[model samples]
Target: MSGLTNNTPRPIDIRLHQASRLLEIKFDNNMECQLSCEFLRVYSPSAEVKGHGPGQEVLQVGKEDVNITAIEPVGNYAVKLTFSDGHNTGLYSWDYLYDLGRDYEALWLEYLGRLSAAGIKRKES
Candidate 1:
């Protein structure tokens, strides 16, 4: 996917609910989403999770209890998420975050399917 464009919707508010382990984000487009920390960690757009090329994605397991320890801004375009597991590489752009929110259900289902196919059971949180 391409980076942010001039028309990209930026987040107007971002709140991290530590107790619930959810990141609630509202965009300028009037769209709001509450993404689980585990979801964000598993779908991280980093080389360690997404890999460096197509078909090289490393399936992220054992992250059912993962949480975001920090949300550091990366200039005006993205935020660097620091996971409790020490993963801090993915630079999540506004476009990508919006997409992740919009496509949450489908993406989550796909991840579950991949795990099932690989016979990897997620640890109960």
Candidate 2:
């Protein structure tokens, strides 16, 4: 069990820009992704962020100022995000990250709509 598994990544690159709150992920297959901090926060894979299931996610609010504090690699296929807001349980897999990037716009709007419905405003930092 000491040896690496067959699925061990040959290569993957994740670049984070603190000023921009953006992550640029380059896959081994040549696919590239650009993701925003807000996008990543709402789509966090942690139960506190995502809830137990669909339709149960607790809407993340007041997070307009949140930023990634660190990107810790998990094995070969995922990374753990340490957020400035103190959330670090979300284990973001490559597949999940890809889906988040692909569905960014719709998801973000939905989240904003939720905020509006709850009378929550993102405070300026």
Candidate No. with top lDDT: 1
* Backbone clashes under 3 angstroms, per model: 0, 0
TM-score of each: 0.96, 0.82
Mark the regions of model 2 whose C-alpha exceeds 4 Å error after superposition.
Answer: 1-11, 123-125
Whole-model Cα lDDT per candidate?
A: 0.93, 0.79
Residue 111 displacement (Å), model 1: 0.4
Best by TM-score: 1
User: With candidate 2 superimposed using the best TM-score fit, by how many Å does residue 10's alpha carbon deviate from the native?
Assistant: 9.4
